[model samples]
Target: MSDIGPESAAGKRTLRRALLATRNGLTADDVRESAVALAARTLALPEVAGARTVAAYVSVGAEPGTLALLDALRARGVRVLLPALLPDNDLDWGEYAGEGSLARVRHGGRTALSEPAGERLGPDAVTGADVVLLPGLAVDGRGLRLGRGGGSYDRVLARLERAGTRPALLVLLYDGEVVAHVPGEPHDRPVDAVVTPSGTRRFR
Candidate 1:
């Protein structure tokens, strides 16, 4: 790991593994309780409170939960969008209707993902969102998110940029996953904020 976490490739992999291991150790009850708190903390964000359309996702395995947050956002009349992974690892968007509207999809040799089962909206559909909720393993003080390295959300962010849309980008994570620093590149866009179970952290 580099003395400074940012810009060090090895630092990201090392940190990501550690964070994921900690998450995998969480109990089911722990995940449930944290999800409730995360929902409350994230729902209170001014950007989310004012958003008409929010692009979000479903959490799987040990990731910080998003189902409760998704439901809460929908209850507030926000049009929530979820991603369905394509074969090439790109994403396709679909609206979140409710719990019943989700379907489990298992990619070969990968953890099954719960995605929206409704109409298949084109990928560019995310450009209409007022807020975009990202799923991540950890985030640093400067709002640099450490993702799963799947490059899916990276594509989403690039699409948003190409469309000249600058919606508030947010990541959901466990409280302890908020770290002092994270490795990143110039092309790696820092998020606007990170919502943890305890509170929210905003960055430039």
Candidate 2:
């Protein structure tokens, strides 16, 4: 784990803002093209290809899209799990049936999200996953991810740690979102790899 200093928080916030701004600047067509490229790269990862079960999320708006990848995984007979946000911001799990199985959900003061409209699986269901696909604003060379400040995935990571489950963690992002450094804290666990539109970067 990387050491966190007094400046880490401010630096993280600044980087988050910059990354969000850049993502917002992308046109719809640009996001679509990137999503296609990202899905191909992510699907080629050995971790994803070998996993029997994967916990992934539906990409909203400017985030690197995941609908195509989710469907592809389902067609491959991989059990795909999607997240449903809980009242406290922790995520609940559900099976991804297909594009039609998702419902548009709007949380308070947040952008609308597409979530699975299936049976609700307990949060611990993620423990059974062989690989977990995480959403993030950016990821540094060290594999520290900068999330959207929701802290939802933080709870998910904490739950996995408590259960001693060691699943391969991955983040999908645009080529530019991979950076040299990301301000990280002790609770922030590094990911095993990042799949971007251009390629994948693995961390030790």
| Per-residue lDDT of model 2, residues 43-96, tens digit only | 888888899999999998899999889989999999999999999999999999
lDDT of 1: 0.90
Q: Which residue pairs in model 1 clash with each other? A: none
- After superposing all C-alphas onto the true structure, candidate 1 shows an RMSD in angstroms of 2.4
Clashing pairs in 2: none
Candidate 2 stretches greater than 4 Å from native: 1-6
lDDT of 1 at 25: 94
Q: What local lDDT does model 2 show for residue 198?
A: 79
Estimate TM-scores for all models. Answer: 0.94, 0.96
